[model samples]
Target: MKYFTIFASRNDTNDMEAVIREVYTGKHSIEKTGHDYTVTRKSLFNRWRIMLRVLSEDTNLDYFESNIPGMMGFYDHIPFADEHRKKLVLTQISALNTMIAIEAEKELGDEPFRLCKELLSKIGGIGFLQDGTLLDYDGQVIVYPDGSSGPADFHPRACTRKIRGEEIESEEGERRRQASIHELRERGIPYLDTLPQLPPVSECRWKSQEEIARRAVALLIVIQYACDAANGGELDESKAFVMGLLSKYGVEDQLTEDERRLLSEEQPDPQEAVNIAWQYEAYWPLIWALQLTDSLDFPDRICDSSYAIEAVSKWGSFEELYRQTALRSREDILDAADKTYRLHWACVNSRIQGQDAPAGMIESIVMERRRGLFWMVGCGMEDWDHIPMDT
Candidate 1:
C-alpha cells in the first residue's frame, strides 16, 4: 500500500478545514463532516439561516476496537486488528491551536499523497515522513539540520493565551509562593483529568541552544511588532515584514485572538495593546533559559520589561546571542513547568471562588511564564501556538 501524508501548523482547525474544503470540493458550495459538527462552508447571499444536523460515528473500527493513533506514538507500539487486513488511520483536529501531522493510505496509487501535497501547499505547512524526510509546503525535500529536533524544530514558534472575564487585581503584596497541591485539593478543575501528562525529558526531544537563542530573539521581535499593530501602529496589510515574520516563525498562528484581529482591522483595540505589551512576561523566561539572566523574578507581578528588552536586544546578532546561549536541562525546565501548571490552577480556583489569587499569585504572569516553560518542555508535544493552560 502507498500512503499520503500532510502536516499543518495552524492556530486553529477552523480556517484550515475551510481551506481544505476549498481544495477538496473545487470551491463548490457543499456541507461536510468536521471534527465536532457538520459544517457548511458556502455563504449564500440573501439566504436565511437554518437549523443543522450532525453526523454520528456509528461505524465500528477494526472489529469494534481502535486506539486513537494521535498521542500513543507508533502503530508498532501496539499491534491491533486482524493479522490479515491492512490498517491505516489518522486522527486529531486542531479545534484549538495545534500542529497537525496526518497520513492517509490507499491500497493502490499515491493519489492520497498527491491530494495531501495540494493541501500542504495551500496551508503553507510542512511534513515529515515515517522514514525521516522533511518536506516543504510545496512537497519538496528541505535541508534537515544535523541531529537536533523536536516539536519546536518543526513548529518553531512562541505562544500566548487569551485571558477572559474581568481583570483580576495583580500585586506583590503577599510575599508567599502558592500553597501546596493538597491545600488546593477542594478547588479541582473540572477538566483537570482530561489534560495530557507532561512527557518525560528522556522521552521527548528539544530545540538546539542556537535555535532556542534565535527563537527567543524572534519572540521578542514578534511581541514588539504585534503590540505595535494592536495599538494603532500600522494596520495596512501590504507590509511584507509582518508577513515574513508570521510565516517564517509560524508567528501568525501563535497570536492571541485580539492580536490576530489587529492584523485585519483598520482600527486597533487599546486594551488588547496593553495586554500584548505585558506579554513581555512570555519572553523573559526564554532569556533565562538562554542564560541571559539568572533566575525568573517572582510571578506576583509583571515581568520587568526594561530588563527583558535590554537583555535580548543587547545581542548584536543571532550568532552573538547564540555564542552566549546555554539552554537549561529539560528536567529543570519541566520542574518549573510543573510548578507553574499548579499555580495556574490556583489562579483559576481563586477566580472561580470570587477570591483574589492565592498569595498574590498573578494569573497572567503565571500563564505567560508557563507558556514559555511549556514551550521549552514541548508541552506534551503540543504545538506552541495553542498550548493549553489547563491545570
Candidate 2:
C-alpha cells in the first residue's frame, strides 16, 4: 500500500504528468486528485517505465527530485554537466540512508526524531520550512519554487584533457610486435643480430639424470595406487590390471621383443624394467610407473614419497585422476589418462631438448593438462626453479 510521487518544477510539470499518463493509460490507474498525481500498478516494470518516460521526455528537470511526506527534500540548482552533478546527488542520498538516520533507529523510541534533527544540521543545503516546503542552504525551494525564483549558477566541476595524444599499445599490439620481431630474426636480419644475444641453453639449470631416475620411481608408486584401486588390492591382480591399461595406451610398442618376453617371467628386476620404459619419446614415465609397480613389491611407496604424495593431492584422487586430463574425452577413463600421459611426456622431452624451444611452449604444454602433475610427477614446471634444462 506504500506509494511515492515524482515531482518537478512547474515549468515542465505538465509535460512530466502527461508522459506518465500516456504510458500507464490502461496498464496502471493514475489519479490527479490534488496538486500531486498518484499512480497505482501491480507491475514494478510499468512503474519503472513511468519514471523512465518522464525523465527521457523532460531534460530540464532532474530525475532524483522527489517528495516524501515525512522526509526533508533535496535539490541541486547548479547547472553542471549531467555526469558530475549526478555523483553529488547520489552521494547525498547514500549518506542520508546509511550514515545519517538508519531505518533501524526508528525502533528506538525517540532516537529517530533526534537523528533527523542531527541529519538536517549536518547537510548544509537541506531544511524543512514552516510552510511544508523543503529549502536548500541557498534558500531555494526544491519542489515547485515560486515563479520569481531562478536556477542557481555555479562553475561546472568536470573538465577533459587528452592524457596521451597517441593510442596506447594493447595486448594484441604487443603480440603483433613480438611476432614481427621473430619473423625478422628468422630471416637473419642484420639489425636484430646486433642486439644482445641471450645466454646459451647449456648455462641454464637442468634436471640431473639421477633426479630423472628418482622421479620415474615416484611415478611408479602413483600408478601402483591406481592399479591397487582398480584390481581389488591383490598384488598380482593389480599388476595384470596395470599391464592391461598400459597395453591399451600403446606402451607395448615402446619395448623391444626381448623385453616383452622377459615381462612374462616371474620376479623381473624393477630398475631394468624402468630403464626400458625410459627409451620411448612419449608416455615413458607413465609406462615405467606401470611396469615397476608390476615388478617391485613396494607397498605404501606412493604415500611415503614426497613427490608421489604431492602428485596425488594435485590430481584430486587416484580413482578420479584422469577426469581433468583433457577438455574432451573418449568415454573411457584409461584412454583419457593415456592421452594426458603422452602430452606430458612430449612437454618433458621438449624441455630436455633446449631452453628456447618455442614461445609459450612449456606454458602451452602445462595448460593442456592438469598443472599439478607437471610439478609433482612430470618436470616440476610449477616449481620452475627445480625444472631442469638441457645442456
RMSD of candidates 1 onward, in order = 17.7, 25.4
Cα-based TM-score, every candidate: 0.46, 0.18
Q: Where is model 2 poorest over a 10-residue stretch in terms of lDDT?
A: 156-165
- What Cα-based lDDT does every candidate model obtain? 0.51, 0.32
- What is candidate 2's CA lDDT for residue 231? 37
Worst 10 residues of 1 by lDDT: 85-94
* Tens-place lDDT digits, model 2, residues 1-391: 0111122212223444554455445655665543334444456743321112223112311222121101211233323244343333322322221111112211223432233333333333243333334334344444332212224331211111211101322443334334434543464321111111111222223333334333333334334533344333554665576566444433344333434443454554455444333222112333223332122111112222344334333543333443322211111212222233333333443444444323233423322222212322332233412222211
**Native-referenced Cα lDDT, model 2:** 0.32
Q: On residues 1-391, what C-alpha lDDT tens digit does candidate 1 reach at each position?
A: 2333444434444465566566656323434454322222243642211111211112212211122222212322233332111011111111112333442222323544565577677866555565544466677654223322222222222122211111211221011112223333544421121122344455445656655666576667656666676556654543356657556544344454555664556565676556556668877878888778899866888777778878866766556656777878766666666567766755665565567877767888988888878777674556545555544
